[model samples]
Each structure stands twice: as structure tokens, then as C-alpha cells.
Target: MTDIRHRYRKLVYLTWFLTLDLIMFGAFVRLTDSGLGCPDWPGCYGKLTPLGAGAHIEQAYQAMPYGPVSWGKAWIEMIHRYVGAALGMLIIAIVWMAWRHRHALGHSARLALFTLLAVCVQGAFGAWTVTHKLMPLIVTTHLLGGMSVLALMTWLAARENPGPPVLLSTRRWRPWLIGAFLLLTIQIGLGGWVSTNYAALACMDFPQCHGQWIPDMDLHGGFSLFRALGELPSGEMISQAALTAIHWVHRNMAFLVFLILGSVAWKLRADPVLRRPATGVLLLLLAQLVTGLTTIFFQWPLLIAVLHNGGAAGLVLCCVTLLVRLSRKSTVPQGIQYDKHRHPGSRLAPAPISGTD
Candidate 1:
């Protein structure tokens, strides 16, 4: 049992680190605008890395020095791809480990398998995201998929560690907390879409859009969510209004999500087990808000932008972990046993009427 526990813990730590690496690679992909730099799935210009296709990359860069196929862009895209592959390999290993030690880890084998399947689908969407020229919908799904992978790995890690079961008093809030976490996940997805579409500065002001509370929003054209990769349904290029709409929705949703999560945090503060995570959520929320505002006010500093995304991901993980912990029934202490004498309820006939009795 001890050996199994140690192995599970090690796997959990490894998955956690790999998940973080995946997140960093994701950031790099977005920052360099290399979502389509490779223009191929599982390879860069038909090779595994940029170095493998040095001649092609050189020609492309020489053809257009400022184009998306530049050396830096290729490297960024290639690195992201490599990291993604590494994550995939790690997930495969996790699944294998779970299967090999199914009895020791109890229910984690199934969860590990699910994660493996999820990452496979995520990889598909990633390919589609690039192949389709970063279609807004596909891109958004791809971003959320990465986050889901992170959340799943985090959940797996927690299950392996299995912290002290939450008290019954706290368990009652678990469902609501889970709901809040899901809502935040969706909001984060929208934020990702906004960022991927380069719509972060669409509004350029808080509490208003272009000096007006609502500015003239072309919702019909702007939010034609079923449009093509880069072209609108009307066969026209996607307009700034569409970008503004995406940005506006994400920005406005941030405020509502903040209120909801803040309320949850406040409610959970009394429980010591929950207090630490509650405080963490609050701190990350504040940091996200600041980075978000600073991005707009400072013309979208790269570092702040990346940090905002990372903070959002971290917040989601923390919320999900807290929810999972709070959902379990608290365990009784070792010394506690069924004894009618201790309770003195009188109505209860506890335990067996022993032969000695």
C-alpha cells in the first residue's frame, strides 16, 4: 500500500508539471500569432520541428520577412507543437500507469483513461484550429480543450493525494461550487476567443465602449458565430465590430463572474480547509482584473496579457479542486465507534446485543 501510494504521488506530480508546461506552450502559441505558422498538423512545414525544415523556413522567411512564417514565428509554433506532443506522451503514460496499477489506485484508472481520450480529441481540435486558419469557433474550442486537460490532470492529482475528506457542513455547498466552476470555465473560454481573435483592445475603455455605454454594436454581423474561418457568413471579411462584440462580451462577463466567485469565496471562508483556496481564488481574481485592465490601459503589454491568461487557468484549477474536495463526505475519526452509551439517545438500539450482554 505504501509503495502504491508513493507511485501515485509521483505520477500526480509529473502530470501537474506537464500540464503547466502545456499551458506555457499555449501562451507562446498565442503570443507569437503562430496558431497557423506551421500550417500543418503534428509537424512544422511537413517536419517535426523548424530545424527539420530549415530550407523551407528560410525560403518562407526570405520571401516575407514580416510574414507569419518568420523564423521566430516558426520556432514559437514548433515549440508549442513539441510541448503539446510531450503532453500527449505524458497522458499516454498516465493511462498506462493507471491500468497497470488499477487495484492500487482504485477508481483512478477510469479517470486516467478518460483523460487520455480527452487529450486525443483536444489534439484533433488543435490540428483543425491550425488547418482552418484559426477559425474563431475552433480556436475557442481548442483553447478551452487545453484548459479542460489541465483541470482533468489536476483532478487526477488530487484524487491520488486524496486530502482529508471535507466535513458534512461544507459538503452541502459542493454542487453550487461546481456550477460556479463550470461557469468560470465557460467565461474563460470566451476570454480565450477574444484574445485569439486579437480583440483585447476593441473597447479600449472600462464601463463603456468608445466613449458610449453601449456604442453602436453590430450584433447581427458581429456575432454571426457560425461564420467561416476568416470570412463572415455574408461573404465579407470579418469586421472590427465582430471583434468588438467578442471583446465586449468577455469584458462584461468578467464582472459578473467576479461577483459570483467572490460570493462563493466569501461563503467558504469560515471553513479552514476551504479558506486557503477561497483566498487563493480571491487573489487570482484580483490579479486577473488588474492584468486585464492594465492590458487595455497600457496598450496590452505582452507579459501582462500572458499572466492574465495563466491566472485565469489557475483560478479554474483551484476552484475545481476545492469543489472536488468539498463534495466528499467527511470521515469519522479513528477513536469514534458505534456506542449507544456515548450518545445516550435512548431511542437507538446500537450495535449487536452481544452474548456477554
Candidate 2:
């Protein structure tokens, strides 16, 4: 059982890292307009690998000579799928191994189970994203789904990483941090909505929408979630004003999210125990702001847009790590610990969430 736990922990680490890579690769696919590269799902052109997708690719080209179909897009989308499949297999192993150790590992086994379920759901969303022609809501939800899975994986990995958490005695840090994290998560979702709808260019000028503080906007149609990429639920072409609304929300909400996360990181830095990591988080927050603005300034360059997506993923992990530490209570607190607060039978485990550690 002990050996199984060790192996389980390694799988947790592997899944968490791979999920991060998959998130960034997903961004590459979205930014490069390769979401429909293969114009199919679960398999690229009815094959497990892109090389085997050749015949289908040729058919795609012939039907729409100047359309989204192409050799490069197929490979890129398939690579993302391949990576996702690898992560899914790792998740399966995690579930089996964790269940095998359930008597000893307790709730961590349950966490592994939930993670398996999440991956399955995420896979379904991935399919809908392609099949629905990248509907704004589906695509945005799909992006969040990936981030959510990554967060779960990170929490799971932290739980299995052999240690009791290093707690900091900061006042009301938990709720404050939680609130900030939630706000940031919402902001990320808004950003995803903007990206999926190609609304980033809706506002060509910074700190203003079309050189006006409040440009013409159709909030009603802009936020309708059930429609295709650029159409209202009524199938009417989404108005330019609607696109402007999407851009404006993401643009302005960024400032509010930054203020919350920045203040939290800055305040946490005052704690001698957390100064280093807090400082690092502050740096990340700043970098996120830069990448976000640069995307607008540079007309949404591929590299900057991809980095913006990666930045959001990193921020989620940082928030989770901070929350995990805050939730801990340790007799000899310093750095991460294992087993004491994480006993299989104990109520809370202080890592990977739900005391899953």
C-alpha cells in the first residue's frame, strides 16, 4: 500500500504538469484558428494520429480550398488531443492506484476519483467546442474547464506530496484570498469569452473602447451564451456593438481583478514566512498585466496571446497553492509536510483540497 501511494503521488505530479502543457497548447490551437483543424473529434480524420489523417485532410482541402482545413492545423489540433489523451490515461492510473490505496490514503482516493470525472467532462466539452463551430460560450467554458481540471490536478498533487502544510498565521487570509481568487477566475472566464469570439480587436485603443469611454454596445446580445461564434441566439449576426461589449467587460474587469490579486499578494508579502512566494506572485501578476496589454497593443500577436493564456493558468495554480497553505495548521510550521494533517481517516488533509492529502 505504501508503495502504491508513492506511485500514486508520482502520477499526480505527472498529470498536473501535463495538464498545464495541454492548457497552453490549447491556447495555441485557439489563437491559430486551428480548433477545427481536423474538422472532427476523438480522432483526427478518423485516425488516432495526424499521419493517418491524410486522406481525410485531402478531402477537407478539396471541399473548402481556402477554408480552415490544412496539414499544419490538423497536426496541431491532433497533438493537443494526443497530449490530452496521455493526461487522461494518467488520470485513469491515478484513479485505479488511489482506489487500491483507499484504505490507507482515504480522501485522496476520492479526489482522484473526482479528477477522473472532471477529465471526462472536459473531453466532452472539447468535442462540443469543435462541433459547435467554436460557439463563444462553449469555447469559453471549454477553456475554463481546462483550467479547472488543472487546478484539481494541482491540488491533488499537493496533497500527495508527502508533507503537512506550512501554515502562516495571517488574519483572515483565507476568505480574503478566496474572494480574490474567485474574482480572478471570473476575469479569466471573461477573457476567454473575448478571445473565443475574436473580440479582442473590438477595442483597438487601450483604456477606451473605440476612443470612447462607453462605446455603443449591445450587452443583451453580446452575452448570449447559446449562440454560435458570432451570432445571436436568434441566428442574427451579432452586432459590432455586442462585440464591443465583450471587449469592454474583459478590459475593465482586468483592472479590478488585478487590484484584488495585487493587493493580496502585496499584503501577503508583509508576512516574513510568505514574503518570497508572495513576491514571486506579485511578479506574475505584473507579467499577466503586461501580456494582456501587449496583446492589445500588438494586435493580438500569437505569442503574446498564448502567453496571456498561460499566465491565467499560472495564476490559478498560485491561488490554489496559497489557499492550501492558508488552510493548514502545523505544530512545527516551515515548509510543506505530509501525513499528520493528511491521515486517511482524518477530516481534513490540508493539501490537494478537501484534505485530500
Candidate 3:
């Protein structure tokens, strides 16, 4: 049982890291405008790899030089697909091992199975992203789906190694903790919308957009979800005002996120079991602020934009870890003896949770 547990832990850890990488790579594909490089599903130009599709790629390039379909971009998009495919296979193995060891693994097996389901759905979104011609709604949903996979993997990995249980007293913090998580999720969705619509640069100036605290905006058009990439449902091209609305909403929401997460971090810092993730949330919040402002000041440099995306993922991971830790039930037997000199302020065990970070 110990050996099986160790092996499963190693596998879960690997999958978690790979999922994180895939999220960042997915960002890279979107940021580089390579989402449509292949212009097909699963395979590049209807072939398994870009190598065999070279002629088609060349033809497309010749048709429109500096277009989305080029040798470099096809490779980037194909590599993203290949990595996603490999991650899916790894997830399958995880489900298999989890089911095989379900008796000892307990709830983690189910979590692993659910992770498999999520990856499959994410794969569907990936296909629709291309087939739908990169529609803003579909692409944003795909982005959220990728983050969902990362969060689930983080939770599953956290369960692999049990830690000193969180105290019952910490239950009072649940509302605030969960609220912080919800706020972050919504902010991420808005950020996705901004990216999908190329609205990051809609308001090139920070704190004030277009030299106004509240610029002219089309709230209804900006948030209409049933339109094409840059068109309204009426088949009219979207205006700059609509894009400005998207960016403005996302920016204003950032201030709220900062407030809620800052408060949550302060609350969690008082708990020894949750301090690590608290610090993580604080640091990531600051990083998001920095990268977000620099993205505007510097005109959205590739590295800064990608890092901003990554910081969001990191925040999701931290939030999940905190939730998992807080959900643990204390297993200390009644009347258990404690060595006060060696283990201070601990009623159950001396060590804190292992995966809080």
C-alpha cells in the first residue's frame, strides 16, 4: 500500500505540472495568434503532424503572406496539440491506476476519474475553437476549461499526501475563502474575454481609458456572447466602443479582486496551516497588478502578457490548495499525548500540510 501510494503521488505530481505547462502553452498559442495556424481539428491541415502538411501550409502562406498559416505558426499550434494529446494519455493512465488502487486511494480515485472527464471536454473545446473560427465566446470558454483542468489536478495532487488536519475553528473562514475563489474565477473569465476579442489594447492608457475615467462604451454589444469574433449578432462589425467596454469592465473588476483577495490573504495568514497559500495569493496578486500595468505601458510584450496569464493560473492553484487544506478532517485520537517542548501550538501533529504551496 505504501509503495502504491508513493507511485500514485509521483504520477499525480507529474500530471499537475504538465497541466500547468499546457495552460501556459495554450496562452502562448493564443497570444501568438497561432490558434488557427492549422485551420483544422486534431491534425495540422488534415495530417497527423505539420511535416506532412508542409505543402498545404506553403500554399496557404503564398495565398496570404504574414497570415495565421505559416511554417512557424503551424509548428507552434501542432506542438500545442501534440502536448495536449500526450497530457490526455497521461490522464488516462492516472484514471487506470486510480481505479486499480481505489480501495487504498479513496476519493482521490474519483477525483482522478473526473479529471479525465474534464480533459476530454477540454479537448472538445479545443476542436470547437478552430472549427468555430475562434469565436470569442468559444475561445474564452476554452480558456476557462483549461484553468478548470489545472485546478482539479491541483486538488487531486493535494489529496495524495495527507497533512496535519485543519482545525475546526477555521470553518468560519469558509465564506470569505470561497468568495475569493469565486471572484478570481470571474476575473479570469473577463480576462479571457479581453484576450479573445483583442481588447487588451483597446484602452492603451491605464487608470483612465482614452483619457477619461469612464470612456464611451457599448455595454450591450461588448457583452453579447452570441456573436462572431469581431461582429455582432446582426452581422455588423463591432466598434471600438464595444472593445473598450470589455477592457473597462475587466480593469475595474481587478480592483475588486485586489480588495477581496487581499482581505482573504490577511485572514488566512493567521492560520498556520494556510499561511503558505496566503503568501502565495498575496504575491500573485501583486504580480498580476504589475504585469497588467506593464502590459499597457509596454504595449503588451509577449513575455509580460504570457506571465500575466500564468499568474492567473498560479492564483487558481493556490486557491484550490487552500480549499483542500481547509476541508481536511482532523484524525487525532482523543487523549493523544503531545510533546510541548518539541511541537508547539499543535494539538494533532507537529507538521503542517505538505502541499499548501
lDDT of 2 at 246: 92
Q: Per-residue alpha-carbon lDDT of model 3 for 111-157, expressed as tens digits?
A: 88899999999999999999999999999999999999999999998
Candidate 2 lDDT over 58-129, as tens digits, reads 888899877778888888988898888899999999888878778877788888889899999999999998
178-213: candidate 1 lDDT, tens digit per residue: 777877987988887777667888888877888887
Q: Which residue segments of model 3 deviate by more than 4 Å? A: 331-357
Q: Is candidate 2 or candidate 3 better by TM-score?
A: 3
Q: Pick out the ten consecutive residues of candidate 1 with the lowest summed lDDT.
A: 346-355
Residue pairs with backbone overlap in model 3: none
Best by TM-score: 3
TM-score of each: 0.89, 0.88, 0.93
Better of 1 and 3 by TM-score: 3
Let me know the TM-score candidate 1 reaches against the reference structure.
0.89
Each candidate: what lDDT?
A: 0.78, 0.82, 0.90
Model 1 ranges with Cα > 4 A deviation: 331-357
In TM-score terms, candidate 2 sits at 0.88
Candidate number with greatest lDDT: 3
Rate residue 266 of model 3 by lDDT: 80
Displacement of the residue 93 alpha carbon in candidate 3, Å? 0.7
